[model samples]
Target: MRIKTVQAWWVQIPIEESRQHVSDFGRLRTFDAAILRIETEDGVVGWGEGKNAAGSAGQYAALVHLLNHEFGPRLIGRDASQITAIWEDLYNGSRASAAAARGHALPELARRGLTVAAISAIDIALWDIRGKALDQPVWALLGGRSAPRLPAYASGGWADSAGIGAQLQSYVEAGGFRAVKMRVGSMDDRPQVSAQRVRAARKALGPDVELMVDAHGTYTVAEAKRFAALVEDCDLAWFEEPVTADDHRGLAEFRAATMIPIATGESECSRFDFASLISHRAADILQPDPAFCGGITEAMRIAALASSFNLRLAPHLWAGAPCFFAGLHVLAAAPSGYIVEFSLGANPMIHSLSRVPVTVQDGMIAVPDAPGLGLDMDTDVIARYARQ
Candidate 1:
């Protein structure tokens, strides 16, 4: 079936409790999601979400513009079944060569973060359509079930800015979570202060719970090493993006210096970037966000590449329901030792968009078996939060 129409929506949902949730990046205020919907000629519609890398106003606008003006027009009237060809065409045609041929003054689109985000949304929507047309779950189409329920970790504990440890305590006491990820590097140039926060979180979490720290690429190589040394006794599950994701050599050096496994790639957009990450031995765990890393197709490729390098897959999910469900399918079909990152924050998009809420029971997320992404979208909620 040919793609009949493509539409994108920019939704900005205000955070209910606008407390200062400080990460290394800064305070997060709202959830901005660029939602894409693709319809085939016969009236099958599929949903997808684009990555809002830093939750900036410009980033959201760019994603919507890329999909609406650049990517959507190219996909209309094309056979939806040719997923591979469509992906390649979008990837190659959006690059510098195509821009030069078309005399477009726009920058090189292949490596552009906004371009990749748009492509990821379209690719995911196409996959959803494929799964619905074939009457199979996306995971089944990928290969088959590798796990009944994917292991999940509650990601929260953003430096208790209110001086009340209620957030972290609540997450730790939350019975279903087996592991929890806390934010570090909120002290900016001081890794020592961030290390102190890690120590406090470790103490509050107690023993037996797997604790992971995310620096959000705020630390330098020396600072990361120093922080690693300070927290060596806490027994961290992994150190996430201690250095900037683009610094492969720095990441490798940080990984070598620390005993904790290094997990990164949430900012990564393509398999080629991941190839560099793996080839350089930059990370022991690769966290590819399907919404950012060219959707399910490229994420699967990243997973395979990580597996070949004896690394593990733990999808980095910080988007809406569509992306979360997509991540579930990836985790369900991925090899063993893979974990799913479950956001433990207040996101109406994740909590209110789906008819059925996703829950982690005993630290395991039950895989949805319905066709496509298996999520029944809540249109009312979408309308309520749609940006005017």
Candidate 2:
């Protein structure tokens, strides 16, 4: 089928609880997502979501604009099944624009940051359309089902204004999450303070539960090492983005200093960047978010690269329902070491974006059997949160 129309929405749903979540990026009080809907000539519609540039102002608007004006126009008349060719065209188009501007060459990550997110959403939507046309699940399209249910980890435990420990305890008790990840490195300059927060979360979680910490790339090599040293006693599952993702050498240094497995790559957009991370031995676990890493197509490439290196793939998901489903497919296709990250907090977009909210049962999420991400968007929810 041929592409007919592409639509994008810049949505911001208010967090119901309005809790102050302190992280390396600062406080997060709303769920901002860029949702994309692609329509085929045959009347098939598929949905996708771009990662919300949390702290960057106007990033969401830029994503919507890029999708509507640039990417959408290019995809309008193309064969929907030519996903690989379309992805190359998009990547080359972005690179050509950079080359025409000046002799200055923006790094792959920097160049992709400008348009890859828009490309990601469009690519995912196209895949969804393809799956619907073929009447096959995305996971099956990727490769036959690898597991019955993928293990999920609760992704909350943010340093809430009320109490980090209490927030974690409540999520575990209510969600039945076997594993949890908490925010760390909020006090960038103070490793001791960050370590204290990690200790508190471990204490609340006790010894039976698995605990992980995400620094969100807020620390220097020295700071990450110091914090890791302090929290080593807690037996962390992994240290996520302890230092800036860009600092591969620094990340390697941090990894060498701590026995805790290093996890990075949420900001990475392509397989090339992930290859660099593996070559540099920067991380043991690779967390590529489909919304940020050039959609499901590129995520598969990154997953293959990770598997070759025996590195684990745990998709980084913190967006709306579309992203969550996209991540789920990737996790389902990934090897045994993979796990899904489910947001534990209350975000109206996550709970309401689709007619049937994605849920975790007994700390595991079953793969959706329906075609094309197996989700039906709730237009009412989109109308309620669409930017006016």
Candidate 3:
């Protein structure tokens, strides 16, 4: 189907103070995303999302502007089904033709960051359109789902040493979650304090519940090592984003020193960045965010790397509906896929944004079989919270 219209909105849903959790991203007052809509000439519409910052705390006006003023215009009258070609076209810019002919990327200088995030939104929308046009789910189009339901881990814990345990337990009791994650690193002032919080959570959840700690890429290599050493007996499921994505060498070093599986990449963009992680032997798990890592196409490419490299795939899903659904589809189809990250924080992007709210039943979420993303967008939510 030919693309007819491309539009985006900066949906900024305010998080109530009581429900909000503070992290390295600061107070996280608002949940932000570039929510994209792509409609075909035949009236088929698809949804997408893009992120430029961590934990739903970035300014999406720039991302929305790019979609409306720049990327959106490029999609006009183009074939919505040729996803890969479109991705390459947007990524390579003027050199797309040459890049295609040469069988590798000769990308634009602005190939990463906001540029890729913009492309991510478009690619996700195209996939949604492709699935709907074919009258199949996105997972089915990719290949087929690995299982009917996948395990989900609660992905929010910002409470301090005393309160963190109760907070995580509340998530476990609320969703029947067997696994949970908590924040560590910079927010706690020191590695030792962060370690104490993790230990306290471990004691509360007991040995049966799976525990994970995320630094949100806010730690130095030395600090991550210290945190890992302190919690060595806690038996962590994984250590997520212990160090910044910029320090692959440091990540690899910490990953080597610790027995915990190193999960990072939500801050990263595209398959090339993932390839570097693999090449450096940095991570045992790859955490691609469908919104930021070049959408479903590039995310699947990263999944391929995970499968090939014998790494685990647990996509970062603390994002909007399109991105969240895209990750579910990827996890369903990808062989390397493991657990899903279900946000425990107050996120309108997932539950409030959809008519049929996605729920995790007994620590697992069912893979959707409906055409495109099964969860229908709540137009009212879009209209109400949309930042002009």
The better candidate by TM-score, 1 or 3, is: 3
Candidate 3, TM-score vs. the true structure?
Answer: 0.98
lDDT of 1 by residue, 17-43 (tens): 564355545556777788888999999
Give, for candidate 2, the lowest lDDT window spanning 10 residues: 102-111
Per-candidate TM equals 0.92, 0.92, 0.98
On TM-score, the candidate that comes out on top is 3
RMSD of 2: 3.6
RMSD of each: 3.6, 3.6, 0.9
lDDT winner, 1 or 2: 2
Poorly placed runs, candidate 2 (over 4 Å): 55-58, 94-110, 160-162
Question: How many clashes does each candidate structure show, in the order listed?
Answer: 0, 0, 0
> Which residue pairs clash in candidate 2?
none
Give candidate 3 regions above 4 Å deviation. none
What's the lDDT for all of these models?
0.81, 0.81, 0.91
Global CA lDDT computed for model 3: 0.91
Candidate 1: TM-score? 0.92
